[model samples]
Target chain A: AQSVTQLDSQVPVFEEAPVELRCNYSSSVSVYLFWYVQYPNQGLQLLLKYLSGSTLVKGINGFEAEFNKSQTSFHLRKPSVHISDTAEYFCAVSEEDYKLSFGAGTTVTVRA
Target chain B: DAGVTQSPTHLIKTRGQHVTLRCSPISGHKSVSWYQQVLGQGPQFIFQYYEKEERGRGNFPDRFSARQFPNYSSELNVNALLLGDSALYLCASSLNRGNYGYTFGSGTRLTVV
Candidate 1:
């Protein structure tokens, strides 16, 4: 079974500032990593995923994440954040079964 | 195209009662999964179904059950509900078992009193 751990539960940042959300995982075998965003009272939307090849993966909304194999980490980063970036972000992992194991999630609050 | 859709955006139930939630996967999606999210927490996996068969189940109790239909739609049923069962129930769909990212529904908010 694979598991994910998100370091922070909440992060507050000023608009236009850079932000990074930390995530780590433990897996017994090769796995797929994913990031999802959820707006208040809304469904989760895929932000990005790291399947294979390309440790640096770019996502929608100008967000990106780097897959560190040795560190077992996939931290999300954005050069500049906007108020619209405020949402709950989840880090997840899945093995060949594709049964996703999710982290507790980190809430990003971008304030003007 | 429409994303995954869940029915009954909100529901209130009494303890020991039974409740059912519904979900319709995106067109051409053959895999459906269910998840439960508690307040201030990330979603937890509950079940995964593909081709009307059970593929996986989470750590939830036997009281929690689900099934998929021929059309790939699914229903989640919880029996003898407890207060702890109150949470947002999410449905997700993927084209195949190996699909990477899933399309999720807005979720049904179930409150057990």
Candidate 2:
């Protein structure tokens, strides 16, 4: 079985400031990690995913995440944020292949 | 592409009633998965179907069921609805039942009153 833990429930940052959302997971086998962002009343949008080969994965909207196997972590980061970046972020893990276990999402509120 | 599409964006049902949610996967995608997202929480997996067959299931009660069609569209049916079942139900489609990116639909928000 696999489970994900998001360190923070909510993170607030001013526009143009960098931000990081922490995520950790526990699994007995290899895992695939993903970061998804959900706008209010909207579906999830894939921010980035770490399948294999690369530990540092870059995604759309200038988002990136690094998978640390030793630390059992995959933290999402952005150099700078915009007001439109305010959304709920989710971290998920797939242990065998398909079934995904998600964390309690982190709500990112970008202020002006 | 049309991305994943789920029907009846919102629904209201009474306790002990049943509800059926619909989803149309992206064209050419053969895998569909169901997830339930409660308020202030992330989505939890319920079921995964691939090639019209059950591939995986999450830690959900037998009251939760799903099926995939030849066209790869799917439906999620929940019986004996409870107030705890009130949440956003999400449908996701992938090319295969693998560790790949999945396109999700604007979930159906179910309210059990």
Candidate 3:
């Protein structure tokens, strides 16, 4: 079984400020990592994914995550954020592609 | 080019009642999975179906059952629903049983009173 740990429960940042969301995982076998953003009353939208490639993977909305194999961490970062970036974010890990274990989630509030 | 679509965006039911949620996977998608998201929590895996067969199931009890159709659509049926069953039910679709990432639906909000 695989599990995810999102270290921060909530992150607050001002508009145009940089932010980072930390995530860690533990699994007996290799796994896939993903970041998803959920707006109010909406489904989760994929922010980025790390399958097998360069350690640093980039996704939509100017978000990028580095997959650190040694630390077993995949931290998401954005150099500058906008007010629209305020939402709940989730970090998920999967041993099998069909089953996913998600973290409790982190609420990112981007203020003006 | 529609994404995964779920029916009855919102539903209200009473305890001990049975509820069935529906989902239509993306065109050409062969796998559909169900998840439950309680308030203020992340979504939990419930079940997954591929090619009209059960491929994976979560820790949920037998009271929670699901099936897929030939068209790749799926239905999740919860019997004797409890108050805890009141949550957002999400449906996701993938191209196959492989490592392809999943595309999720908007989800059905099931509220049990």
**Top candidate, metric DockQ:** 2
Model 1: DockQ vs. true structure: 0.83
The candidate that achieves the highest lDDT relative to the unseen native structure:
1
Docking class of 1: high
TM-scores, in order shown?
A: 0.98, 0.98, 0.98
Worst window of 10 by summed lDDT in candidate 1 chain B: B95-104
Model 3 segments more than 4 A misplaced: none
Decreasing lDDT order of the candidates: 1, 2, 3
Candidate 1: the clashing residue pairs are none
Which of candidates 2 and 3 is the stronger one according to DockQ? 2
- Candidate 1 yields a Cα-based lDDT of 0.95
lDDT of 1 by residue, A1-112 (tens): 7889999999999999999999999998998999999999998999999999999999999999999999999999999999999999999999988988899999999999
Q: Output the better candidate (1/2) by DockQ.
A: 2
Q: For model 2, state the Cα shift of residue B5 in Å.
A: 0.6
Evaluate model 3: give its lDDT: 0.93
The residue ranges of model 2 lying beyond 4 angstroms of the native Cα positions read: none
**Of 1 and 2, the candidate ranking higher by lDDT:** 1
TM-score of chain B taken alone, every candidate: 0.98, 0.97, 0.98
